[model samples]
Target: MTDKIVESEAPLTLVGGGWADRALLADLRRHAPGIVAADGGAGLVLASGEMPLAVIGDMDSLDDAARARIDPARLHRIAEQESTDFDKALRSVAAPLILGAGFMGARRDHELANFNALVRHPHRRCVLVGMDELVTLAPPDLTIDLHPGTRVSLFPMRALHGWSEGLHWPIDGLDFAPDARVGTSNVATGPVRLRFAAPGMLLILPRDALDPLVRTLLATPGAWPAP
Candidate 1:
């Protein structure tokens, strides 16, 4: 069973120790009001003049001053060294949707691990927000309204096959795999719809599409069962 550290009916914002600025945090808060930090992310949250509802991680990156500022009750430490702090925080949050910031930029490996976490925790409905784009693990099925000539990219963490509509090229019979076939730089002709046979497909879209994507994900009936 998953141990939930923070549960919310509304969309929640998750902060990490990566590259997140005040402007980005403020924009994310408009959609996801509640904030939670991952390890040293507590410092970034505090610097924004906002208190995190809970701080979840291995507690190594959290500094003395930031630790002293946060209430002891809100600090959650997971000693396991295998998973990244992004994985820890994503698993601990139980919300309709999660808007993640600070998980991208700075380190290339960390950004890649963020994508790995999205595929690892397929059941978690979360989106990682970057400066120019948004990334999320595509559910079994997803539909979103997009303007003509909008960019839509699909990357597979595991080998999977899927179908698409309103794309410049159809994906009905195409094979997708990380080592071999990957979908990127696809343009949407209009409103786009997609369905995959399994989990592990990551969807990348422009940063401006965050609101619509969140609405579509939440309104979708069911999610892929926890692996």
Candidate 2:
């Protein structure tokens, strides 16, 4: 088993080497004060004039200058080429919720991989913050209060079935699969409630919903067990 690099009771902010800005970082830190970096994400953390509690990655993208700035004890390198740095960092963290920035809005392929990592580690409740939206894996049962007409998109990583409330188009009998029917651009009629038969559904919401989503996930008792 991979040893945990960070164990936190409060939420953690995980920065990747993607398109993150100072405002995004500062906003995320407001909810999740503890910070960790994924590979070259150390550069972003340093640029923000703050140091991460730990940097977990393969060390390929992390530069020498950033390496020199960080304390040696905080750098935990895993010399394997199989997984992405996002995967490494996500798996190593034991937190109630992880707010990830700089993992989206850069490369499409990297953003896709980051989504893949979310489902891959269902036990880790993480929300990836983008410029305009936030994405997270739908827990076994989730309820969030959102305004009517809010956009709630659900993308499946694999085959699954689910039911919903407060969505304009319900997903009761729908068979969701990556290659089959996918839920996107769905509108909410009121407060939203979602229950998934499996652990592959990705919940996409507006960036403003991060706080309520985090609260819902933390309060919900139903979470996918580690596989």
Candidate 3:
């Protein structure tokens, strides 16, 4: 995938957790070389036998050991409490593609809020990674490069109004409400190209499906929102 960290094999990113911090770090290192810790995530970074390029978020959650173990140059703390550590991690990294975990599964509010954050950012090339699936919001007025057999899900954060050129169930002139009218388990039709008149949100899984996804993006130009 274009957004993936390691290109040699299956590109994946592992996000460390506060509980399984040590275990998850090791697991990620074994699988994917690109692993990042957010705030308290440095704990696992040290134990993982690798140094994180950046340790992000406000210093509130970070402890003395986490700070001492990681280098100061790589650390970026956002004193803005209005934003979250997750947002800090997202902003700090320049990775065109991202894979994340432990971002969810902590608290209900944290999980739900993080999911919403993914929608809010709407990075043209990013994945809100998890144990189950990979997620990303589609760029406004653009096509999604996906494999013909790839699966997709369209979840409306606020209210969605758009149509699609290719998908198992192409939505059109439809108003999608949150928690309802959510699109899921859709099979890709050729290269998935979604031309959205208005900005909208969408999720995708790139495993066993990323090949076509990359090819799709190669042919289609990306969309940029009006500032």
Candidate 3: misplaced stretches above 4 Å? 1-36, 141-150, 206-220
lDDT of 2 at 176: 91
| Per-residue lDDT of model 1, residues 11-60, tens digit only | 99999999889999999999899999999999999999999999999999
Q: Please report the TM-score between candidate 2 and the true structure.
A: 0.98
| Model 2 segments more than 4 A misplaced | none
Candidate 2 residue pairs in clash (backbone atoms < 3 Å): none
Give the alpha-carbon lDDT of every model: 0.94, 0.94, 0.61
Error of 1 at 113 (Å): 1.2
Is candidate 2 or 3 superior in lDDT? 2
Q: Which stretch of 10 consecutive residues in model 2 shows the poorest summed lDDT?
A: 214-223
lDDT score, candidate 3, position 104: 55
Deviation (Å) of 215 in candidate 2 = 1.5
- Please give each candidate's TM-score: 0.97, 0.98, 0.72
> What is candidate 3's lDDT per residue for 114-140, written digit by digit as tens?
766666565534555444455566666
lDDT per residue for candidate 2 within 13-67, as digits (tens), equals 9999999988999999998999999999999999999999999999999999999
Misplaced by over 4 Å in model 1 are none
